[model samples]
Target: MRDLFEDTATAFALKTDSELERAYFLFKLIGNEPLVRIGTAVTNFAIKANLPVERLIRATVFDHFCGGTNEEECLVVADRMFEKGVYTILDYSVEGQQVENQLDYTFEKTLKTLDFVKEKDAIPFAVFKPTGFGRFKLYQKITEGEQLTFLEEEEWQRVVNRFDKVCKKAHDLDVSLLIDAEESYMQDAADKLVEMMMRKYNKKKAIVFNTLQTYRWDRLDYLKKLHEDAKREHFHIGMKVVRGAYMEKENDRAEEHGYPSPICPSKKATDENFNQVVTYMLDNLDLMSLFAGTHNENSSYLLMEQMQAKSIAKNDPRVWFGQLYGMSDHISYNLSDRGYNVAKYLPFGPVKDVMPYLIRRAEENTSVAGQTSRELTLLKKERKRRRI
Candidate 1:
């Protein structure tokens, strides 16, 4: 059972030789910390200077990482992945929105995606970042319990409206909606808002899913409290558990603000916390639905092991395994091949607008120990097998 994920032929079966080489090259480039840093700096400058880098970007990293510049363009990728038994979560990865119009644009885009996926099983979920729907400082203020001015209150209501619109649409259409977890300081407001949505729409099942960054030491407590509320209120709980993406930013902010870091002490501790939380969720599967968002083989194995131990079905509707589209085909394809519910986060946006997300992916690949190396190792194995 453990060896199932090692089947590279099944993993990369859809990748042509050239695409396989491109992936190997991208991972190889991402493995170098210094190179990634310089590349990010250069790319940011080019975008800021209004340089014609979109075509070049669209030809390289953008093509590899994102589906396309819009929802319609994402269908090709979504359909292809669905053909192989993996589902897609269409992610509008545009960043740094500062105006209400842009927020509405994201809201409308999310609504449009929900409409597109309403009748299509290929796309099971639609996702959006909270900061995309509203300003970061707005969430920070609410999270900090600061007083809101009258106009600020109106602005907050608009944000709430955006959340409600999407969650309600998702519920009405029976499509699951995933609200992403952001920085620790702002996540409190998002979590509360998501819990409210869950209470509203999850009476029948988990239609609104909140993300839990398991790297936070207190996430287990949060999950327990959520479970308690669900038990009392008769609402289903849906949570996507990820190791986390903002460790450095979180630690730095804690140091700057003179607060104890919310992050776990070390990777081992975080992994343990992740495992423990998943165990808790599986143990209480009756009222909670889990979206295990990870690329770690051991964590994937642990979930499979627990499912078997609990006599759960592989295609269980209450459980899912998720990975980013371009990063973890091995896990995504192999899991779906074995009949597990799986979804890939297929980020899509214009090249210039999506650079921030693309850059972060590069930086994350560089910073996360062993992730890039593992990709390289697998890509190399597949490449050698094809004598490429």
Candidate 2:
């Protein structure tokens, strides 16, 4: 086990003892409950004021989880990751801005991001959210299988056009675009849109990737269906699977309505489904490219074990790993050390506009069983090691 972990640690060449210590300390600070609560309060307050919370955010979540405040600023961090033999996936974190002009601005920013990626070869993926380009009500209609108003129907077309532009830009630039998954109710539209774009643009290479939230029971089955669909379409599938981000709200909404919850009934079920999906993807590595977006040590190690079982190479381009920037240094560094292709989801946006993202990170860290404790424990261990 030690040797395996050590081997995985080889990919992170940029982290010195000092940098690791800094990461440990940052995680430890964020894991503190009182600190998280205070940080959340201040950031939300700042959001209501429309003031830039960069300083407050930089001292809190962003300092741990993001690449930088903007694209230009992120290059230094991306360079560090490249120096360590890892890649960067730039994610634009602005969400819930609904005006049509705002959507145009968002689409332009996405194009600019793709242009930046073309100019910088180290960035492997450009990440965007569908909600960034479409109105929430329109997405709700699509997910509900309901008819849209005349205005909404037009807006929906515009949404599709925005995706066409983004996907075309990515295809032209020869970079991958990852369509991020949102809440379950809205996710169907995202999945369908990505499937459509992939069929159109992923003729010879994987230009569009869809994210699967394994915390939802339906997603594992959806993954199977996606694979079948891709086979029928005769195009490669790019998959990014995560445990999911909307647990509390998902369950609350399910209980509010009379519908059964889409999320797995228990943590055990979620873990089981996640592992099953990972194994299935590993078995079909020839036609699928996967990014396992998780921080669980067991899951990471098991992925490696499954790859070895199939006699797949450690650095197989079909398989990559990721943890959010600042959240799982150990996982990222260790996996990089093992000669695997690993990247960080490096979000960059104005702090006020990004508060929702920051708040969710706080909530997720709090809810994942023993996550805060684990982070605190690791920090203490590193501190003790330094003292010794």
Model 1, runs deviating above 4 Å: none
Q: Model 1, range 1-388, lDDT digits (tens) per residue?
A: 9898788998998899999999998999999999998999999999999998889899889999999999889999999998899999999999989999999998899999999889688999989999999999999999999999999999999999999999999999999999999999999998999999999999999999999999999999999998999999999999999999999999999999999999999999999999999999999989999999999999999999999999999999999999998988889999989999999999998889999999999999999999999998999999888885
lDDT per model vs. reference:
0.93, 0.80
Q: Of the candidates shown, which would achieve the greatest TM-score relative to the real structure?
A: 1
TM-score of each: 0.99, 0.92
Whose lDDT is greatest here?
1
Q: What tens digits encode model 2's per-residue C-alpha lDDT throughout 1-388? A: 4344333234234556776666666666566778878877876777787776567557755756777779998999998888776788888887889899988988888999998888886788888898888877788789899988898888899999999999998998888888888888877777788889998888886778888889899877787887898788888888888888888899999999979998899988988888999999988876688889998878888888888889989888778898887666667777776688888888988766676887877777866777767666655566565567
